[model samples]
Target: MNIQELLVTGTRLLKEKEIPTPRLDSEVLLANRLSKDRVYFLSHGDERVLPEVERSFLQDIQRRSRLEPVAYITGKKEFMGLELEVDPHVLIPRPDTEILVEAAMDMLKEKTGFVHVLDIGTGSGAIAISLTRYLPQVKVTAVDIDPHALKTAKKNADKMGVADRIQFVWSDCFQNVEGIFDAIVSNPPYIDREEMKGLDANVVEFEPVKALYGGEDGLDFYREIARQAPGHLKKGGSSSLRSGVPRPRRSEGSWKKSVLDP
Candidate 1:
C-alpha cells in the first residue's frame, strides 16, 4: 500500500477501536516507520511503502488499536524541544511537565555561579537533562527508585549529550540523595488510587504504575517533598513541583512550593 492508503487504513482501524486522535496517531506511526516527516505524506501520497515497511506499519497500527501510546510504540518522545528515548519502563514525557521545567529554569536562570539541581523520580531524565541543556551553570543529580527507569533516563541523557551534566542515582524520593542544592525539581506521581482507576487505558495500561500512583490521595509525594526539602535546599532555595491541582500555590513554611497548574 502507498502512504495515503496506509494512513487511511490505519486511521480506520484505530477509529474502530475507539482510540483518541486516530488520524494523528496514524500519521505519527507511519512517519516513524518510514523515518520521514509527516509533511512527506502530502507530496508523496502515491509513493508505495516496501512490503516489510507495510507489515511493520500495520503491526504498529494493531498496537495502537490495543491502546498503546504512540511514544511507546515509536520509543521516542519530545520534551522541551529535545527528542528523548522512551519505553514501557519509563513514563512518557508529557507537555504538562514542560511547565515544571520552565519554572525551574526561571529559578536557576538568575543565579550566578555553578548551580546544583536535584531531580527526584527522574524518569527518562526529562527534567534533569532539559535544565542542564538550557542552563549552562546547572548540573543535576537525578535519582529514581526503579533501576530500569534509571537506565532509560541515563540512555536519554547520553542521547541528548547531557549525560556528563547529570549524575544518575538509585533513590526513592531523596532516600539516597545527599548535599544541599540551589534548586530541587520534580514531576512526581500525583495521581491518587481513585484517579488511577479512571485514567485512560492508553495511560494506565502502558505507563508504569510506580510512576503514576501517589498513594491514597494525590498529595502523598507532595507532602513528602515539602517535609524533606527544607533540609536539602540551600538558604532561600526554591522547589518547582508538579501537583494535580488546578492552580499553583506558594508554601508559607520552610520551603517554597512552585505548585504548578494542572
Candidate 2:
C-alpha cells in the first residue's frame, strides 16, 4: 500500500476508536515504521510502503487503537528541544512543566555563587537534567520514591551527557535526603483520588497511577515538601511549587511563600 492509502486507513481506524489527534498520530506511526520523518511522508505520499513496513504500521495502529500514548509506542518524547527516552516506568515530560523550569531559571538569575537544586519526584529527570544543561555550573540532586523512575531518569541523564552533574537518590520524599539547596523544584503528583475517575482512559489505565494520584485530597506530596523544604533550603533560597494548593502544616512556618512575578 502507498503512504497515502495507509495514512487514510490508519486515520479512519483511529477515529473509529475515538482517539484524539488521529491524523497526526497516524502520520507519526507511519513515518516511524518507514524510518522517515513526517515531512518526508508528506512529500512522498505516493511512494509505496514495503509489505513488512505495512505490517509494522498496522501493529502500531493496533496499539494506538487501544489508547496507548504515541510517546510510549515511539519510545521518545521532545522536551525543550531535547529528545528524551520514555517508557512505562516514568511519566512523560510535559510542556506545561517547562514553566516551572522557566521560573527556576528566573530565580537563579539574581544569584552569583554556586546553586544547588533539589528535584523531588524526579520522573524522567527532565527538570534536574534540564537545569543542569542550561545552568552548567549548578549542582543538581534528584530524588524519586520509585526505583524504576530513578532508573529511567538516570538513563536520560546519561544519554544527555549530564549524569555526572546530577545526583539521583532513591527515597520517599525527603526521608534519605540531606544538605541545603539554593532551590527545590518539583512537579509532584497532584491529581486527587476522586478526580481519577474523570481522567482519560489512556492516563488512568496506562500511565503509572503512583505518579498521578496524589492521595485523597491531592495535597499529600505538596504538604510534605513544604514542611520539609526549609530544612534543606539555604537561608535566602526558594522552593518553586508548580501547581496545586499545599495543605498547611505547622513545620512550614519558617519558610515564607512569595508569589513569583509573571
Per-candidate TM vs. native? 0.94, 0.91
Residue-level lDDT tens digits of model 1 in 85-202:
9999899988989998998898799899999999999999999999999998899999999999999999988888889989999998979999999989998888877888899988
Report the Cα lDDT for residue 45, model 2.
Answer: 87
Clashing pairs in 1: none
Q: Give one clash count per candidate, in the order shown.
A: 0, 0
C-alpha positional error of residue 37 in candidate 2 after TM-score superposition, expressed in Å = 2.2
Q: C-alpha displacement of 1 in model 2, angstroms?
A: 1.4
- Lowest-lDDT window of 10 residues in candidate 1? 253-262
Q: Model 2: runs farther than 4 Å from truth?
A: 244-262
Q: Tell me the deviation in Å of residue 32 in model 2.
A: 2.3
